[model samples]
Target: MGNVLGLESFYRRQLRQLLGIRHPRRISNAALYKRCNARPLRYRITKARWVLFGQVPRGSDRNPAFMQMARYFDSSTEGGW
Candidate 1:
């Protein structure tokens, strides 16, 4: 959670700098995103994470990493790592 917040803060600061928006000319985050026609950084990160997670199950079953992941998800494993 701390990492996510740090990333978001960095993203916002960069965007503000890119658009030449300085302290005197304050803008709400929503307005800044609207000006750039972009989604929040968190949304993009979450979407990417979901996409990668979806691909993991589609990986070859013979892969040892996939087998271990399958075991981790199995009911008999009781959610243990």
Candidate 2:
């Protein structure tokens, strides 16, 4: 979940910074749904993350829940990022 959010944020920020957009781009609900239905795993996990967590909370860089999520996904471990 955390990784998905991070991936989305990274892509969003890159698009905004590179394109000089003042606001985030609008997501196409229909297209997004179709993509998910067509390829659950191959499709972007960020959208799924958004559906599940609807804008994840922010605070410390080392939030415990974030760490635990990473660990569960095998992306990171106790030593932390």
The numbered model that scores best in lDDT is 1
lDDT of 2 by residue, 1-81 (tens): 666567656655554455454555554434443544533332556567675553334544387766556566674356544
RMSD (CA, Å), each prediction: 2.2, 13.9
Clashing residue pairs, backbone N/CA/C < 3 A, model 1: none
lDDT of 1 at 47: 95
Off by over 4 Å in 1: 62-65, 76-81
lDDT by candidate, in order shown: 0.86, 0.52
lDDT, candidate 1, 1-81, per-residue tens: 789889888888889999999989999989988998877878988999899788878999997868878888788756485
Worst 10 residues of 1 by lDDT: 72-81
Can you give the TM-score per candidate against the true fold?
Answer: 0.80, 0.28
